[model samples]
Each structure stands twice: as structure tokens, then as C-alpha cells.
Target: MNIKEKYELSSRYETAKKDYEKWGIDVDKALDILKDIKISIHCWQGDDVTGFEANNQELSGGIAATGNYPGKARNAEELRKDLDKALSLIPGKHKVNLHAIYAETDGKFVDRDELKPEHFANWVKWAKENGLGLDFNPTIFSHEKAADNLTLSSPNKEIRDFWIRHAIASRKIGEYFGKELGQTCLTNLWIPDGYKDIPADRLGPRKRLKDSLEEIFSVEIDKKYNLDAVESKVFGIGAESYTVGSSEFYINFVNKNNLVPLLDTGHYHPTEVVSDKLSAMTLFNDKVALHVSRPVRWDSDHVVIFDDELKEIAKEIVRNDSLDKIIIGLDYFDASINRIAAWTIGSRNMIKALLSALLIPNDYLRKLQDDGNFTERLALMEEFKTYPLGDIWNYYCAKNNVPVGEEWIKEVKKYEEEVLNNRK
Candidate 1:
């Protein structure tokens, strides 16, 4: 077996061991190698069988409440329960994506009545008490005028004010979460302040959003708080149509703000820009984290698929050294049937894609390093494009795949022996 096969086999064993541990089943074998698998799977509150079965079992994290879920926690008390449930499912080291507040005047952002320190204190306390990890994503469009919901209004003052307060509050929240949790604060800031009917050069809202972020970073959040600004696409109708979270804007905004950019795959799949999305992310690997979920053209399916199109995008992300930035959480809507199972299936497919990326022959990558040819690298990607990304994993994992495991372990031993002999 080659080096890639060696690592793949070792990874499979390590993940299997971890999976067994969850059910109180221990594997009596060497598992020192899985210590390096840094990938994480995303989970949400309602996810049940589908999401669970599809989960990497080896690596999983708590779910984040998508702002649209009306039944989810909107207050500290509700959040505590949410945190508790999430913590109960995963291992001790997993994390949770916290929806800081529903950003509508009619929602939690305003219901809290001017965003007090205690409201946030409640969240921090809950996380600490439950040992649940927390992340942040603001629902900025919740308060817009009924008619002007996801776009910039004529005055746009209320929206601007909402964001100003939100930015300030988020910064404060980031600092508190970081100091209190020892875990970095991840703020997924989605810009809903855009044009609806006609393009609005209403640069004021954009400027305020950016300035607020910069000011927050300057004034709050320790270096650990990764303020990942997410640009999301909103799906709706006529007067309320919105799509500010596109590659066109995010690439420039992140570069300009000196903050990390987050891309939601579902947001752009409808636009046929998945490849461009990957290209932009590749160039900005140093400043991007992926929100990987399935997108069905016009809607945010949040389903995960190993579709050929997404498969290629996944390859590019892994090839570009950006897998570390990926947070594999399901963006599934709570109202969907078998929602949890959907998340699991999607997550399973997602892990398969990630494994495929990991198994890509290192020699091919090394050749790119040696040649320093950018075009050649892209061509190489095209060359190995047809391989079933995750099926290699299923082949060994679905049954008594022990032979696959032994063959791989031997390969690793051979590599180790070669390296030790060379050193001597």
C-alpha cells in the first residue's frame, strides 16, 4: 500500500475505536494515530436518526440554532436546556454553535430590551455549568419593516441602528465568552442589509456594518475570538428578495476587513457558482471557514450530498489546506420531516468527502509543490475528479473490514521503519 492507503487505514481504525467508545465498546488495539483527525461534524437540536446515523461517530460537535427556527431557544432559560441536550449527545470535547440572538425588533434581540450584560451572563453561565461549547451567529434581518425585511429600506435607519447595537453587543459577548469559556468566540455575521427591488448604493449600511465590526475587534474580543463574517443568501420574494451573502461581496469584504470569511455552500449552489465559490475560497484559505450543507438550487436544503459538483468543490478545499477551517455542521431546517436523519445522512456523506480528500495521493500534491505550476495543480484536480469520494471508506467500514485495517497498519509500520533507517 502507498502512504495515502496507510494513513486511510489508520484513520479508519481510530475512528472505529472512537465510535465504539461512545457505546461503551472498547477496541483493544493500537489507536495512537487518530489523534490527528481534526475534522468536526455539525449537529442541531432536532436532529435525530438521520443526522445521528450519518454523523462521523468519530468526530462530532453540538448543533447551532439557525435563526429561522421558531421553536428553538430564544432566551437564556431555553438556551440552557438546548445546551444541556447538545452536551448529552456528544463527547466532552465537542462544541455548540450559539445563535446569539434573533435579530428582529420583534425577536429576541429586541425582546431582551436593549441587550443587557446579564442576558449574556446567563448564556455564559449556562455554557460553563453544562460544559457546552458556544459559537455566535447574529440574525440581523429580524427587525426590518414587514415589507423591507431582508433589504435596505428608504431610510434604513432602524436597520443601521439594529446592526450598530448588534455589533457593539456582539463584541461585548465575544469578549465575555472568550474570557469565560477558554474557547474562542466564532461570530458568523451575515449581512441582510442589502437591496431588494433595485440595487441600492446605500453604502451607509455596509459601511456601518464594517466599521462596527472593526471597532468591536479593536475594542473587544481577545485574539482567540475568530470573528468569522459569514455572507449568506436569503431566499424569498419580490419586495423582499435578497442575496448579499454571495462570493462577489464576501471575497472583497473579508480582504478589506482583515477578518475571516465564512462560506455557506447552500447559499450559492442555486447560482451555479459552486466552482467559483471554491476558487475564491482556495485563494482565501487563510481567511475562510466553510459552512458545509446541501443546497438545492433555490432552497437551503441543508441536506448533505456527495453529488459530483460538490465533490469537486470538497476536493479543492482539502487540496488547498482549508479543511482545518471547515466546521461540518448541518444547516437543516427544523421543520423538515425526519430532519435529524437528514442531517445524519448528509453528515455521513460529508465525512466521506472529507476522507476522500484526505486519501488523495500525497505524491500528486508533492508534485505540485515541486513544479510550482498553478495551472498544473488545477489540471491534476481535474485528472482524479471521477473517483467516488467517500465510497472507499464505506467499503471497509460496512462489514468485517479488518483485512483492510491490517493491510493499512503494515503500510504504516513500513513507512516508520524506512524513516528510522534513513535517520540512522
Candidate 2:
């Protein structure tokens, strides 16, 4: 940024720091903690969830990324380059969440069930070179195998067995990623196995799903290398009437299996919020995984903003002191705008929300509630909102060597002009 902008940001931050000190909130400590919280940014945003798989099939799951924005990454190389630009603008070191469909298979056909660590060798190498960690997911959509909307829970033993092998293969790939990067890779399983209309036999499918999971997890994998998590969804486009992997089903299965239960913010009814569920999950489970997204009326996967729920989610994590125990990851893909901007904006807002949470004097608020001073507590909560959080956020971006404020937008425009626009 220009010299004038730098001076203004610093001046504003100094004033904000003084205001925070009065509330017993240490700005420096908050920044330190924020820097350590590494969010796993999903790679699908760059390519509109269209991975490097050669099939060129349409997205079939209940999920769909709308808009026809130009310059979507056509291959793994372009996707990585776009991600590099996005990460440059976002502050703090973070991890990249990848799907099995994004595997660089050297122009060879590698089905999901037969996938191996070699298929993702390039991804591991790229992540290491970029100094970022990696997380993984099994691609259970946009394939002939999943055309029926029945994967692990399919009544057909052969089809169910295929997905089970795929899940096992995905875990092995996650293990490879963790081993190479010296960090545990979260391997999440989310299958769009549900019926479009009401089915007479709901129990049968869930039972089969349980057996499939049992088979997938039968082979022991070291927790140090790979952490397994199961995600649940209320409904999907085709699976409106019944979803095999419902929240209740996954929660019970995860608890029984001693696996992490992943709660996707967009995977619930419009009235339900994952922020309210965080405390309970953290209390019960040793570690929890999150797929952070903005859901409109349904699981629309809108770009995340600094909305109330985002702040509440961040507050829950910070207040409960469960930052280390929570696995934070972004799960959204908006194709209408500049893909890089989508990534930068969502990631920055998430960090901003976390910073806001960290800047709050949680102990003081809790003490007020405990002392039955509800009026003072409510007033303080409202007053905290007017604090100069932008100043602190700007200082953070500058300190991290990322562009301060709107300056990053200029870089994105330049990239589009020089690079993204060149794609035919």
C-alpha cells in the first residue's frame, strides 16, 4: 500500500489498542493467537468444485456451484496458481483442503476406488513447497458410480464395496499427506447417498452404511498420520425426502466409533446453527471438525461473510478455549465472482471474526453472568461491537505482509488481466 495508507492504519490501530486495554483485552495476544489459528481453505472454490478428473461430468450431488464466471481453473496447475494468488492476499499460514477428484493422475484414468498416494504426489509436493498443510476428502459425487445417489449405503454389494474401497484409499492418501508434511491430515467422509423421494426402507440403507463404514475403518491407521471424520447432511437436491447420512446417524456412528464428528454449517435446516452446537460437541468429543460455509435458505454454499453466525462460531471457539481442539475449514464455492477474490474475502472474514472473538473479554462477561449482572453484561456486549476492529485487522494484514485493506483487490484485478483472462 501507499505510505499515506500505512500511516493511517498504524495511527488507527494505536487508538484501538488503547480502547481494548481499558476492557482488559490484550490486542497483541489476540493477534498472536489469531496467527496460530490455521484455517483449511478448500481448493474447490478455484475451479468451481470441478476437479482435475478427465470425465468432464456435471456435478450430480445435492450440491451445485452456480454462476458462469470466466477464468475458472481448467486443470490442477491453474487451480494451484489461482490458490497461490488467493493465499498471498490472505493473512496467516493456512492449510489446503483437497478432494480425491483433484488428483493429478498423469493423463491416466484413476477411478476413486483404485486411487493411491501416487495420484496425489504432486499435491503433497506443491503443499510442501508452499509451506502449507493438507486435508483430504473422498469424492462421492459426479461419477457414474454415484449416479444412482447411492454409494456406501447402496443395497447392491458391489457398488457399496466400491465406495468402501474408495474411503479406505482416501484415508491412506490422508496418511501420506500427514506423514510427508509432519502434521495430521483430517480425512473427512461425506457421501451424497440419499433418495430423492420417500423410501419404505430407511433403516436398511443406514444399516448398510454402517457396515460399509465398519469395513472402511477395519484397517487400522495411525491417528498421528490421519484423523477420520464423518459429515452429515439434512437433505440434498435429489435426496429431498431421505438422506442416508443424516446428522443423527453420523453423530451416533462417530461417537460409537470414536471418530470426529464434522459439523458443516450449511448442512442443517435454515433455523439451525452450528455455532450453538459447538460447545456441546467440544465438551463431548476430544476433537471436532468444522466445514464452515454460508447457507442461504438451503445449503447454497455462499461465500462466507462476517455475519452474526460467523462471529458466534468464532466466539464459541475462543471463549471455550478450544482453538487447539477444533479443526477449522472453509467449504464454499461461488463461481459468479473472481474466484481468487472469493477465496480471499471468505478467508479474511473468517480470520476477522476470530480476531473479533479473541478481542472480547470473555472471562469478564462470564463473571458478570455468574454474578447475576445481566444488565451490565448485555450492555457491554452491545458496546463491544462499536470497537475499531478494522484498525486491528488492517494492522494484522500489514504485519503478515499481505496487502492492507482494499489494496489486495488491485492485485486480484491485475492477476485477472495478466493471467486468468488469457484462458480460452
Candidate 3:
């Protein structure tokens, strides 16, 4: 930004800081904490969920990324380059979440079940050079094996075993990522094994799924190298009647197995929000993994905006002082707009929401509630909403040496013109 813009942002931040000080909130401390918060950006966003598998298959498993937006990364090299640009605009050192299908197999057809850490060596090297960590997921869809809408839960033993092997392979790769990068890699398992129509025996499929997961976890890996998490969804496009891996199922399994339960913001009913579930999970689990996204009516996987739910999710994490215990990651793919802009916008807003939460006077608010001053507490909450949050957010972007506000758009547009358009 220009000098004038920097001066204006600094001046505004000073005024906002003074206002926050009255409420016992430390703006500088909040900024420092915000800098440490890292949100893992999903790699699939750059390629529209189309991984670098040799077959060039379409997305499946009741999930699909709509829109035919141009310039989708066609290979690992292109995807990494796009991610590098996205990371450059986003502040703070973060991690990249990769799917098993994105492994660089060097033109060899290494199926998911046979995936090894060497397949992702290029990604590990790139992440290390870029000062980023890595997370992993096993891809269990868009393949002939998953065409029946069944994977780990399939009655057919062969199909179920295939997915089980893939899940195990994914964990091993995640361990490699953590070992090489010196950061714990969270290996999450999410399968689309369900029925479009109501099933006569739901218990059977769930039992089979449990068995598959049990077998996958039987081979123990060190927790220091890999952390295992399971994600569930209420429903999906094809699996409207039932989803084998429901929230209740995963929650019970995670609790029983001492594994992390992942909560995806877009994986619930329209009326339900993950914000209200954070405190409960924190109470039960030592750590939780979050998949941040925006859901219009269903699991639409829309680009995350700075909405009320987003702010509330951030507030819950900050108020409970669970920043260190929560693993934040973005999980959305919107090919409708400029992909890089989508990444930049969603990531920056998530950071802004956290900053807003950190700026709240949590101690004072809790004390007010404990003293039975509900009226005053409610009034103060409303007043805090009108505070100069935007000014503070602008100041944060400036401090990070990134563009303040809309200025970042110019950089993304320039890249799109100079690079993305030439992909074809």
C-alpha cells in the first residue's frame, strides 16, 4: 500500500486500541495471538477437487464442486504454484491439507490403497521450502471402487478392504509429513458410504464401517507423527436418506478410540451450527479439528464470508481459550469465481473473525454473567459489535505487509491475467 494508506491504518488502530483498553481488552496482545493462529488451506480448491490421479476422473462420493471456472490446475506443478501464490497473500505461516489423490506419482498409477510417502515427497519438499506444514485425507470417491456409493461400509468385503487399506496408507503418509516437517499432521478419514434410499438395516452398514476402521487403526502409529480424526456429514446429494458416517457415529467412535472428532461447519442441518457444538467437544476431547466452510441450505461448500456464524465460531474458540487445542482448516471449493481470490478472501476473513474474537473482553463478560448482571452483559455485547473492527482488521493486514482491504484484489487479478488465463 501507499504511505498515506499505512499512516491512516496506524492512526485508526491507535484509536481503536484506546477504545478496547477501556473494556480491559489488549489489542496488541490479540494481534500477537492472531499471528500464531494457522488455518490450513485445502489444496483441492486450486484444482476444483480434481486431484492429480492418472485417470482424470470426476468428483464423486455425494460431493461435487460445481462451475467450470477456467484455469483449474491440471497437474501437481500447477497446483503448487497456485497454492504458493495464495499463501503469499494470506498472512501467518499455515499448513496445506492434501488428498491422497493429489500425490505426485510421477506418471505411475499408484492407487490410493498403495500410496506411500515417497509419492508426496515433492509436496513435502515444496511445503518445507515454503515454511508450511501439511495435513492429509484419504480419497474414497470418484473411482470405480466407490461408484456403488459404498466404501468402508460396503457389504462386499473386497471393496471395504480396499478403502481400509487406503485409510491406513493415508495415515502412514501423514506420519511422514509430520516427521519431515516437525509438525503433527492431522490425518482425517471421511467416506461417502451411504444409501440414496432408506436402508432396511442401517445397523449392518455401520457395523461394517466400524470393523473397517478398527482394522485401519489396528496398526499403531506414533501420535507425535500423526493425529487421526474422523469427519461425518448429515446428508449429501446422493445420500439424502442416509449417511453411514453420521455425526453421532463418529463422535461415539472418536470418544471410544481416543481420536479427534472433526466438525465441518457445512455438514449439519440448515438450522444447526457448529459454533454451538465447539464448547461441548472441548469439554470431552483434548483437541478438535474444524472444517470451516459456508453452507447456504445444504453442504454447498460455498466460499466462506465474514458472516455471523463465522464470527460466533471464532468467538467460541477464543472465549474458551482453546486456541492451542483447536486445529482450524478451511474446507471449501468454489469454482464460480477466481480461485485464488476465493482462497484469499476465505482465509483473510477467518483470520479477521479470530482477531475480532480475541478483541472481546471475555473475562469481564464472564464476570458479569456470574454476578447475575445479565442486562448489563447483554447490552455490552451489543455495544461491542459496533466497535471499529474493520479498522483493526485493516491495521492487521497492513502490519502483515499485505494489501489493506480491496488492494489485494489488484494482485489476484494481475495474476489471473498473467498466469491463470494462460493455463489453457
What lDDT, from 0 to 1, does candidate 2 have? Answer: 0.94
Query: Regarding lDDT, does 1 or 2 come out ahead?
Result: 2
- Alpha-carbon lDDT of model 3: 0.92
| lDDT (Cα, 0-100) at 295 in candidate 1 | 61
**Where does candidate 3 clash, by residue pair?**
none
Our tally of clashes for model 3 stands at 0
Against the reference, the lDDT scores of all candidates come to 0.48, 0.94, 0.92
Q: What's every prediction's RMSD, in angstroms?
A: 13.5, 0.9, 1.0
- What alpha-carbon RMSD in Å does predicted model 3 have with respect to the real structure? 1.0
Q: Write the per-residue lDDT of candidate 2 for residues 301-395, one digit (tens) a residue.
A: 99999999999999999999999999999999999999999999999999999999999989999999999999999999999999889999999
Candidate 2 error regions (>4 Å) = 2-4
Cα lDDT of model 3 by residue, 7-74, tens digit: 88899999989999998888998999999888989998998898988877878888878888889899
For candidate 2, the clash count comes to 0
Q: In model 1, which regions exceed 4 Å deviation?
A: 1-93, 102-113, 116-132, 144-147, 150-154, 199-218, 226-228, 232-246, 269-276, 282-285, 325-329, 365-424
Clashing pairs in 2: none
